[model samples]
Target: MLKFDIFLSALANGLMTGAVYALIALGLTLVYGVLHIINFAHGATLTAAMFAVFVAHSVFKIDPYLAIVMLTPLFFGLGYAVQRFVINPASHGNDSNILLVTLGLSIIIENALLAGFRSDTRSIDVPYGFSVIEIGNLFLSTPKVVAFFASFVVAGLLWLLLARTDTGKAIRAVAREKTGAALSGINVDHIYAVTFGLGAACLAIAACLLMPTFLVNPRIGNAFVLVAFTIVVLGGMGSIAGALVGGLIIGVVESLSGLYFGESLGQIGIFLIFILVLLFRPTGLFGAKA
Candidate 1:
């Protein structure tokens, strides 16, 4: 049997990690929710954002936490322009074309990062990076705990954005029926861009939150992309709530699996559960049936 302290420690770690995972998945899921397409460039966008945070901290002397204020809108605008000009114009209403464009964009972004930053893995050293919160016998990393709470705040804000605002209503209308939304004078293309921007903005926030705890490289985001996709599928393709719940569950499972089976096999459990979810519940825990 596992020791109570050890198990509790793992569980706490899982939740903290899971919260950040959910934040990352929120971007991908939000894009899918509105655009109905898997953004192949999402992980790359995250990579870019992390680099932005890095640049802000190392060069501009802005704190990673403070970088959020600057980078989020910048990325949002970048996302908006990409969707408005590059993706929307090139795709011509075809899903496959959007996929290709995003894939191409990902390749370009990764290569740019490689050329600029090389393949070296970089990490930041904030003053509080080593700080931890002690509770009984458990010590939680401070950055991770802050990330945990911040994830909820972002999710809640996103929910309110979708539920309470006029833009949000327009987004929902376009998501549900693009033609009807357009006919109703809802500027579908603009809404599409906005949704995509929102997705990228989420990535910016996540990058900031993750920088203090995680390492960054051109390829680091790729490591999370598959896991994000799994969370997307597990929680339902377009279900925000599902993404949040699935992330936590996967985090816990990965933690426990790592504890028992070792690091190399830790990811196996995640995929196993993913496969089972696919086979048994293709619609996912919160997805609507097609």
Candidate 2:
């Protein structure tokens, strides 16, 4: 009975953590879906957005949730500029060139953050940030609960945008085939920027939701980006729904592993599952063959 309770607790927490993980993976998958290049700078963008929240909290005494309104456009614009200026010019280059360029950008962003913010850790101090709710033998984190529900809401909205909107149709068209999309009158470059911006925008929302629970630092992106990658690959490189499901699965496995083995072994479980998936389904659970 005690063991079962522990399992339940772990499962509850895992789902909450997975919600945030899905949001992060959504951003990554979106960029990869359209650009055909992984944004290595994604983690840095997350780090930046978290730091932006910290700035709003410190300088203006604003709550992290509300800060999303101010930060989203800025983050979107940054994504737009990076795609338009840095990435677009290199679109004609090989995959290696694109990867190296984004990786370089990531390094620069991390180091710039290190120089600016120093090594000290920072975080928001909301009263309920660390609060917990109890149900029977299970305990749920308030922040995680909030972040989890918010992620679902955002996911639903994203689905609506993609399924029902014209701009969303343009983004999907480009993702399917750039040249084909261009021939059909889509401004491929413009759509690319918008897609990148949308991806970045998702990260901003995640950053704000996560700020209350996570510590801010230069290397913080390093902490979660690997998991984000795992989720992205496991779900499918370009599948948004797959990312969400993958995030939840990874989260549950991680939580259970930590409980039975140890915290360090949790990552091993992820790798094992990832390897199996690669062996059996290289295109991923949701990815379609080209």
Candidate 3:
């Protein structure tokens, strides 16, 4: 039988893990909400960011935390350029074209990483990598705790951006009605690029937070893609708060299920909830009725 204290500890761990998952889902949701395009390259972009952190650490002697400051804007710029120059031109306002372009981009990125770094799994040896916090009979990883809090901070800042900033308002306007937004003097294409950039920036931050605790390889980011999709769908297609709450809930469920059912089998719990959510609440927990 699992001890109550152990259960609590697992719950805590799940929340932390879910926070990162929320960050990943936030990027996906943002893009979907605004552009209405499912960015298949999102997972590859995340892998690229992880690799960016690793290279920054191993080659340039930068700390993972410190790399966040540098990588976030860099990724934002990359995403912007890709959306503006590559995806936009290639997609030509067609949904099928957009899907193909993003899917092709993902394949290109994955193969490029494979060719450059080979197939070896990589991780950094942070000075505080093994540090943990103890409270009562429970122990929590310090990196995870930091990630948990930082994820919320990022999400809050995102909310503030959307709720307060001019750029955010423009993005939201474009999301609601691009033709009206463009007629209102907003640069719709620029907004699309900006939204894509913001999504990539979120991934950069998530990657930095994950580096100390997670392993990285060319394919590592693919692991989060399905779960992120689940969170995005479960939270609703385009709801930010939904993504946050749904991620935490999924995290806890995954952790508890893992504890009782074992690690490999634990993943079934997430899909089960996903299926149930689809069958009963197709619009998702936070999604509006269509």
Best by lDDT: 3
RMSD of each: 1.0, 1.4, 1.0
The models' CA-based lDDT, in order, is 0.92, 0.88, 0.95
Give the local distance difference test score of model 3.
0.95
Candidate 3 residues 1-290, lDDT tens each?
A: 44898899999999999999999999999999999989999999999999999999999999999999999999999999999999999988998899999999999999999999999999999989999999878899999999999999999999999999999999999988988998999999999999999999999999999999988999988888889999999999988998999899889989999999999877888999999999999989999899
Per-candidate TM-scores read 0.98, 0.96, 0.99
- Error at 213, model 1, angstroms: 1.2
Candidate 2 displacement at residue 79 in angstroms:
0.5
Instruction: Give the residue spans of candidate 1 off by over 4 A.
Output: none
RMSD of 3: 1.0
Worst 10 residues of 3 by lDDT: 1-10
User: Candidate 1 has which clashing residue pairs, if any?
Assistant: none
